[model samples]
Target chain A: MDKKLEVRDGSVVLKVNPEFYPLDIIYSAAYVFLDKAYVLLDGDLKKEILVKLQPKQKQDLEKLGGEFLNELINYADYKHRAAQTKTIREYLLQRALFTNDPSIIPDDDEEVDYNEILNELEEDDEELDDPEGIAVPWEEKYGQKDEKKD
Target chain B: MKKKIKLVLNKNFYDKKAISQAIKDFEHIAKITILDDEFGIELLQKEPLEEPLKEEFSNYVLGLMKNENII
Candidate 1:
């Protein structure tokens, strides 16, 4: 496999293309390296993601690079599985919520009739013409002004 | 000696908040500029910044992206 990493200034820098790995995947992989190394992220977020791993303890840099690559692959796999199970997970969650919550089902087997409540409200036909326009009629105001000018 | 590095990031890859946070972290050491769309950022600092400094700044923004779920 072509190594995606390089050792510079005693720091292991891995350049992973954002197209293949994604920022979220890089974040997940970075979290795993936190305990072992002082990790830094660099590079253009659009094209690539750069991960710099400075070991907290003395260790083989080559081995560390290999380990980081493995961690990244593992996290990417996790992301794939999560996406694959999204629908089933959502369905299970919905089922669990409906089954556990008593509010979804009412007691006394009574069905609330919204139509009856709506009918009880006194109907005012005039309310339908509720004017949102200016109260004064335009013709009344303008016509009077024209008469005064005449 | 002073050095300036210009980086043009993908507009879709970053947001203002994340870029602002990254700039703030380096404000002391570097004069930074990030465009309104966050498609580019410039850094000017006395002496070249070690690779780790750039790496940390990137990670800092990445952490924010993870927290905010922008990425």
Candidate 2:
């Protein structure tokens, strides 16, 4: 399979090939680290904000074992996109810490807050304006309809 | 932090005398609750508190069980 995406920096990178493994596998690994590897993370980066998997987090992948990594993606397929994303975020974030990649790893005493207020606003507007486009129902405004309705 | 999620395997992963050599293997990283009467071995792991991660791990274990035809 060809390189599907590359999360790169000066020293390290994760070159993903979608053909070899599904997207969920990549995502689940990331999610695992974000939740379990907090102690391995820089203290400054730990507080004040949620940490996301950096682009270059391939180094720590070995420790999780080949079976675990394989299981991650396989599980992602069994689960759903949201779950896979969290797992991928964890796996990637943990790898970033283990590898000591300065570019991706936040510095000590750094304060970062990830807020998507604009995204939320845009989403809200989209939901209001394009009723059919959104997946979730707007129960308050539009009465719930049976999903199997003809 | 991960919690021990129990999974029972249809066959035990051990032999009586040889198994005694390893102490840590018996101790589950997650949690192995064995149902002696049932035909399976239990595998466990700590689950992350994060909802999505928890669900993924849950599915991962469930997938393993399903894939292996354990349950």
Among these predictions, the greatest TM-score belongs to: 1
Q: Whole-model Cα lDDT per candidate?
A: 0.70, 0.38
lDDT of 2 by residue, A36-110 (tens): 321111112112111122322334433333434455566666666656588557655644564575366345542
DockQ of 1: 0.14
Most accurate candidate by lDDT: 1
The segments of candidate 1 whose C-alpha lies over 4 angstroms from its true place after superposition are: A15-20, A34-50, A100-150, B1-15, B24-56
Lowest summed lDDT across 10 adjacent residues in model 2 chain A is found at: A39-48
Which parts of model 2 are misplaced by more than 4 Å? A1-14, A37-61, A65-68, A76-150, B1-71
Q: How much is the lDDT of residue A133 in candidate 2?
A: 62
lDDT of 1 by residue, A87-122 (tens): 668655544664587365334423243223323432
Shift in Å, residue B6, candidate 2 = 43
Give a tens-digit lDDT track for model 1, residues B1-71.
77777766555545677778778877888788874464566777755655445445555676677677775
Q: Against the true two-chain complex, what DockQ does each candidate achieve? A: 0.14, 0.03
